[model samples]
Target: MNAGIPAAARELTDRLGPDAVATSGPLYDRTRRVWNGAVTNRPALVVHARGTADVQAAVRAARDHGLPLSVRGGGHDWLGRGVRDGALVIDLAGMRRVEVDAQAAVATVDGGATAADLIGAASPHGLSAVTGTVGAVGVAGLTLGGGYGLLNGRFGLALDNLLAADVVLADGRAVTADADHEAELFWAIRGGGGNFGVVTSMRHRLHRADPILAGTIFYPLPQAAAVLDRLNEVLSAAPDELTVAIAMLTGPGGAPGLGLLPAWSGDPAPGEAHIDRLRRLGSPAFAKVGPTTYSDLLHANDEQGETIGHHVACRTRSVPHLTPDTVSALVKAAATFTSPLSRVLCGQFHGAAARVPVESTAFGLRRNHIMATIISWWPPGDAEPHQTWADAVSEALARDALPGGYPNGLSPDDTTQIADAYGPNATRLRAAKTRYDPSNTFTATPLP
Candidate 1:
């Protein structure tokens, strides 16, 4: 035993057993690792929580010891807010349990459960939850920070589908928040990020969606500008069941390309026409569009090598429309990418997601818009050039973008963007924060 270990950590181990707490060694190393390789923070103590009680114990221990605290679910945050240097981290990776009620069309997912976990659990029931495109993203983190995904066109955001949540507060009190109970907390958590408490479990409403028409169509990089313009035109009158994501990335053959990933949740007959419009937009170098399961679509990005262990920097801009100027900027940025691993992705927010009232939840933007995610990645030990490229692209897009970016994609240090993320709901969100966590013991995404 290391004599230098803190007394609080020792006490936690005594309460939860030796297997639950790790001060050093391989377990600590594994628990502390996040998706962004750039973040190298080392927590002094990591508690592998197996249940809500374990999370409560960890939270109380951190409070008693005056240690900074963080919670790790899927640990896919680009900014790596789940593990902080010298903090005591509650590792929820061991608690991923998902339960589905076919009759009710609802799923109760443990906080650590990823999108993949929930989707796999619900697929057998012919249902699907509104989840982000990536399978590995944590359900709790994504919902709290405003989840934007393929189903948003028809079902709204993941946060909007959240029916209730079980949270462990800063004071060590466990409570269930829903529309009727802890109403303010419920509203805040909808889009407020994890600034109030550690969610132990979440109940999400599911939709009947088994087979979805979806796939990607890639064109040569030279046609990016024209493709983007056509994309905007198509989406202008798109149906609620249609959602598309555009990406400018280097393909497998070391060639740059513009790819359009479309998901149609409506009947297969009508979906073919919508897909045909996209194919006609440009001469596709590679196209694959057909009937597929939603689970398969969610796993597409993970299969394409979006795994951990790479230095990455991300920037975001919310463009109300993809005008000529915006398209030009995006094409220029993609053409000048510093690293081959770097890419730009644009997710369209419309239909059901845009119909929600802005003040109904803490999420700032409810209008139809394009969330431009500028991502730059490189091999370990080389970050400067990639980060610079991402920043320059963000700067170029600022003039044509909305006042604030997506809260989920914005970094904690982005003060200006953070201030504007909540828009008119900023004051109300702060009030809720004070009421639930006056001491500010939990701070994941920086609140406005």
Candidate 2:
């Protein structure tokens, strides 16, 4: 234990026992390593909450002690917000319990469930919800941040499918927030992020999507510009049943390439035309677009997990259409990537995402055809070029945008980007923060 441990943390351990409260030792390092040894975090203590009651105790203790509480679910936060230096981390990784009611078409998921757990549970019933690309990302943070994924264009954001949530307020009482219950808090949680409170459980709208037709298609690097141009054209006229994301990366041997991850919710045959058109643009290096289980596709990107070592910065923005200029910018940027692990990604934002009026949810950037993310990866070391590279890429890409942040895509560290993400809704989020957490006790992001 640390020398200055708070009395509240001690009290929590007294009530829940030692296993519930992680004081010092291996688990603490494990929590720190979640940020990949890059960001520095020395929390006074870490509370591993196993249930709603445990979460309640931790919250009350933190509030009573005036200690900042960081809610950690899957521990995949891009900004490393899950564990802060000298704060109490309410680790929710142990609370992963997924209850799927196929008849009701809803899934009651604990705050700790990862995308992998949710997909695995729902896929058997031929049901799924919109989540992030990474299978290990916390469902709570990802959904509240406007989740984007293969199903995004088809089903809109993960929050768009949110039916209800059980959030522990600043006052230490657990309340269910939904359309008809705690309606205002429900709206705030939809896209406002974790600024208001800690969400312990959620009710998500699930769709019947099993054995989905999904996989990635790789093309020669020379055809990336052409591929993006056509992608914009096809997605503009495409239906909500089809969603796709384009990735530009320097391959294993430094061979630059482009990958298209296409997912079709309906019949897989209809997507044949689009896939074929893409195939004709350039010779394929590898292509696996066909009928597959959702679990298989969910695990496809697991290989990248090993590459996350330290500080990683990502910049995102939306463009009306993939113009020649944008395509050329992406092509040129691919050359500057020093890390083979780095990538420039293009995710489609159409279908149900656009059909919803922009004002319907707190998530912004609705009227664009593409969402571009530039990521820089490296081990912990000097912060010079790492910071420069991330800034340059994000700056060059963040030009076009709609108001309000996309929630799922923006990192907590990007305050300016948060403004871009929230746009008009930014003001309301601040006001909600004031009313709900007037003392700023629950502050995390979407800063007031």
Whose TM-score is greatest here? 1
Specify the highest-lDDT model's number.
1
Whole-model lDDT, model 1: 0.89
Q: What local distance difference test score does each model get?
A: 0.89, 0.76
Clashing pairs in 1: none
TM-score of each: 0.98, 0.94
For model 2, residues 115-144, the per-residue Cα lDDT tens digits are 999988888888887887778778988888
